[model samples]
Target: MPKKTRRSVDGSRLMQEDEAMTTGGAPGSPGGLEEIFGSLDSLREEIEQMRRPTGTQDSPARTCQDLKLCHPELPDGQCQPQGTQKY
Candidate 1:
């Protein structure tokens, strides 16, 4: 059998399509870097919010109270062992 030939590809057109997909618009247009950076900033802010601790108190005494509720057999002021606690 004769060797098959490969079809030519338009490299520039492929690049343009890729850029449009990545930037959500034509390359170098207003919807490109600015939009991407804005989205990234919002995402960063969301992540920072998640990292921050909420104002709600989570003291060890509260945890002991909760554990006491879960395991009434345990005496007051006693919490279950770390490995033995129920999930």
Candidate 2:
């Protein structure tokens, strides 16, 4: 009898998914999903972080920089902040 192939989940892939879910950046990193766990507070924090006024401590420009920064899981120029449309 042939054994069934078990699907293996990649840790890096899962981390990237979590980054997207948090809508902020990963912990210890600037300008990512930043959501430790999928909870109401973390989600709200990410939202408020995004809605921050311009020229604040971390301005849109800075966030954009992080967005532009390359990650192992993301392709070049594909890490733009959520809802950003560069048409």
Candidate 3:
């Protein structure tokens, strides 16, 4: 006969859930967030380091629409930003 593990619904279970939520992620997965922000902050710093001199600066300061891609609410594949070209 095999033994079946029992699940608790009270204090111990809540503590377990809390502990799980507090960590960055599971032990081995690279999807953990510390890596993500580190990469993105690095990219933003790279962008800021570029030279955009006066009179010759033809770039939009940052189209608000482009900035939206940085938000969690924006959908993926849309950031390639087709149809946004301005004449």
Clashing pairs in 2: 24-32, 24-33, 24-34, 25-32, 25-33, 25-34
Top lDDT: which candidate number? 1
Q: List all candidate RMSDs to the true structure.
A: 11.8, 19.0, 12.9
- Evaluate model 3: give its lDDT: 0.47
Model 3, residue pairs in steric clash = none
Each model's lDDT comes to: 0.54, 0.51, 0.47
Candidate 1 residues 26-75, lDDT tens each?
55574676677789999997665444422124323234445455456754
Q: Per-residue CA lDDT of candidate 2, range 6-53, in tens?
A: 565457977876775576665557554333445767778877666553
Q: Where does candidate 1 stray beyond 4 Å?
A: 1-7, 15-30, 54-87
Ranking by TM-score: 1, 3, 2
Q: Provide the clash count, candidate 1.
A: 0
| Model 2 RMSD, rounded to 1 decimal | 19.0
Alpha carbon deviation, residue 27, candidate 3 (Å): 8.4
lDDT of 3 at 5: 57
